[model samples]
Target: MTATAPHFEAPPVRAPRRSVQALLEARFAALLVAPAMAVIALVAFYPLGHALWLSLWKINLRFANTPWVFVGLGNYVDAITDDARWLNALRVTLTITFTSLLAEFVLGMIFALVMNQSFKGRALVRASVLIPWSLTTVVSARMWQVIYHASYGVFNRILVDIGLIDAYKPWIISPVFTIWAMIGADVWKTTPFVALLLTAGMQLIPGELYEAAAIDGATAWDRFWRITFPLLRPTMLVALLFRMIDVFRMLDLPFVLTGGGPGQATETLSLYTYRVIFTDLKFGGGSALAVLTFLMILGSAFIFIRVLGAPVAGAESER
Candidate 1:
């Protein structure tokens, strides 16, 4: 009698209104994005699909009489195995990519940090720093060419004055200096873009974090390492991802500066592909190279996206 059983009622099944609402909202969002997706497919996917399809064939536009021969994977095999020029171009591409990226990131970070401080002329400094990045690749490349000119280039003159070298040497020629010259120019122009991204990222960080760190007896270096750097990780990853792709597929700079010349010493993958397609009129081989370049870019992007942490919220959740 003291332990009387309490009666419990079974839960009633509802109309699932919340789930229905969520489903409807999702559908609405998808509908809103449909147009953009369609445009991207039309512009991006169509060309990529066409290039992939074209790569499987042997189509030499030079010989109009010969039919488009289907040599599936043959072009890829040649590029991977038999092509010496392709290998050299790939090497040059990677060398510039890594070297320029490192220089840009380090210098960009320094610039960003300097620009972030509360100092006189900060606004003017920031704007001026972006001038290099704002210039078109062609303009920047031509400008650098003038600076690197053999006889009267400013760079050679400066080096001679500084006694860095005995005499003004060829900056855009001589395989040893050609690639490096391009890298130097690229880093100078691109570092500003990286700095801009980082500065924007820094602005998003809450001032309270810095204030709290200061109260807790953290030095500037300690705060940067423990707070600012961690917070800026996403921005840095984004900057690097953009730069890696741009550097890997670079064409205009090398083409404009050195014409990928002096015996193809600085020929990038894009330059070589351009020569193959437009110069030699080998559409199939050119398309194969394009496809390979796209794949490499995709793979690198995938790795960066992975390291950046998918869902993006995952990084926030970890903290």
Candidate 2:
């Protein structure tokens, strides 16, 4: 009788409630990222869009009454056919890109190999290698400009002293040598950066692989080709892509050193764009050049990724 009838109640079901703190946190995170995104859009994309818009117009800055009338690809036609300067600029630009990139890649690889070897003071050496890269591009260009001066430059003195040349030669003043001189300066300045990236990649490789290869009687070349080269491919592609982009838009060094050269010999697309915008005050034409250069760079990067077997974002994520 006593055990017969105890009243039982069901456990209460919890109700879902919105978390104010979590909502606030999400909002705060979005707020934090929004400023950076806005800045990037304004600084990078806005100008690009504006430039594209300007490119379609026929606005000459010299004419006070000139309206920005839509000219529908006229600027591009002018750039391609009517403007011989664009052709010259393209020739010089391509020459500099190919020659300088080749030299930089070779020298950077050599430097990376050297730096990868175990040695005393290696940390100090690595830090020193980065000094040039850490410096401002303009500052580095100015320093090289002094070094490349015809009469009083240390480079010329050294060349003469070493019997490389009979006397001081005007490197930046001559069209024949100006491109080469610019290439040299660019290589020296950028190779260190390339080496640093390669070195980082190399460091990620296991030392045990090399040891095992050595134990198996693999020669240095064999080990490099079999083990090191394949592993380093991704890193090399990354470095090459970055350097190639920079090379396409190179302006400061050539500008400071030669001001597009003695006879437009060092006139890269960047310098040509600058001259069109500022010197000639042809904003519309300059914008067209800018758009063309942008397209060229984007197309080149796409082609490189496809040709070089680089991993696209989706492939990389899966990996």
Candidate 3:
């Protein structure tokens, strides 16, 4: 009997197999997503590939019977190294981007803080704050254009009333004022969006943390810097990313407000690209500009994800 028991071996352990139902469910989910994937590939990827292809060839519609000439990054090289207007556009774009971003962020933080405070008309105030942002960009630009009119504009009236200027200034016509005026309008329109996003993020922060900080004898500013600011960083980064992408490709405001005018003083990359493509009939050059803009935006997003993603993820995990 002992010899017989010793001769028996334990059954080998086997991993549990996935059920056919689970496999079927996964396949069904993939099938459900296929249509959306196909649409994206068709609408987005196809156009993007076409643009890249077109960027390599010179296609000037202005010339009769001219065939597509392969330039092999000539447009890109011209834009980057040889094109003075392109360089100036780049400078103007960067100036507006950074300046407007800073103003919006600071004002947005202030607005968020004020809105976060309990008040009798907080809801109304928040709704009012969102009004500027709610307007379509084109409409907002048109409105601001009216506001920046040299004569009979409220902006000049306010300045004159405050004794800041002797007369109404030509804000849109002057090169010095044109870009700044655009920056101001951009900040006014977008700060609310930034504030709204920050407010949402602030809501996620636990009240206990603030209370504990207050108990530790931390001042309001101290608490904000030490607790609120740190916690809000992830949200700020996300807002910055969105705003950067938008402002980089900015067209409507500049196009409508100044028409990239006052002699190309306020010309953005997008507006310049538009001019090149449609106005100058240079499809290849315009495509190259579009591709370059896309690359810049993509690079910026990649940097944000790679650099700031870790901290954001860590914050989420901690929470």
Candidate 4:
């Protein structure tokens, strides 16, 4: 009741917001990602854009021409209908892609199944499998070239010993056998990769599922179909896609082994483009071929993802 002068109450003070620190953290994150973006734009996008632009021009390496005359879609037309070479190259490309993919898938699946079992020396076997895959493409091609030689080749010696052939023959020089030689080399080199991927997928499958299937008196084949196949689909698709893309762009093996020779039996789109750019000096036509090859890859990827329900690496990573 003393009625002392009411003490003036001080207004509550709010804490200052740390807006500057938040902004600095965001800036740091952006700075970290900027280098990757720059690298992608420079290495991937720049060449793609240049290739597309060059495809529209009528530029020949042999002729002296400046400003590269724009021929609109003439180059594309030449590549598609006007040239029989492109068609032949396309056929070879598809043949290699499908055939090699099929072989790799079957062999890789078998290898993966074997590796998935508990066995002795499994680590050694896995290490051995990677040796061929680790060899350089050029080295593999040269080694296979030697093996396919008409004289003093291990393959011919083995075939002769086994009574498979009457005499040694030049495998790479024959048009009929050139494609098969290329396919064999490719399969040998790449099947290990497929096995590795499939093995990884196999590891993801729960062992309990197999145990449960066994308790139900399911056979090995039944367990594989019902339990393993579904889980392995994603990885199998990934391996198939990678092999298909590589086969489509394949060049070094066929180039070195057969030189796309014996009348173009093994010539693929990549080899065709190389011939156009280097041998024929048709830069515009080569650029058009490059663009078309890129489109084919892109279109195939889109179709596989859309129709086949394949899981892309990016999508899988996001999940």
Q: For this target, which candidate reaches the highest lDDT against the unseen true structure?
A: 3
Give Cα-based local distance difference scores for all models: 0.90, 0.87, 0.91, 0.89
Q: What order do candidates take by lDDT, descending? A: 3, 1, 4, 2
lDDT of 1 by residue, 1-319 (tens): 4345343224444669667877999999999999999999999999889999999998888876879999999999999999999999999999899999999989999999998889999989888997998899999999999999999899999998999998888999877799899999999999999999899999999999999999999999999999999999888888888889999999999999999978988999999999999999999999999999989998988888776552244334543
**For residues 142-215, what per-residue lDDT tens digits would candidate 3 score against the true structure?**
99988989997889999999999998899999988999999999999999999998888898889999999899
lDDT of 4: 0.89
The number of clashing residue pairs in each candidate reads: 0, 0, 0, 0
TM-score of every candidate = 0.87, 0.87, 0.91, 0.90
Query: Which pairs clash (backbone N, Cα, C closer than 3 Å) in model 4?
Result: none
Query: Candidate 3: worst 10 consecutive residues by lDDT?
Result: 9-18
How many pairs of residues in model 1 come into backbone collision? Answer: 0
On TM-score, the candidate that comes out on top is: 3
Q: Of the pair 3 and 4, which is ahead by TM-score?
A: 3
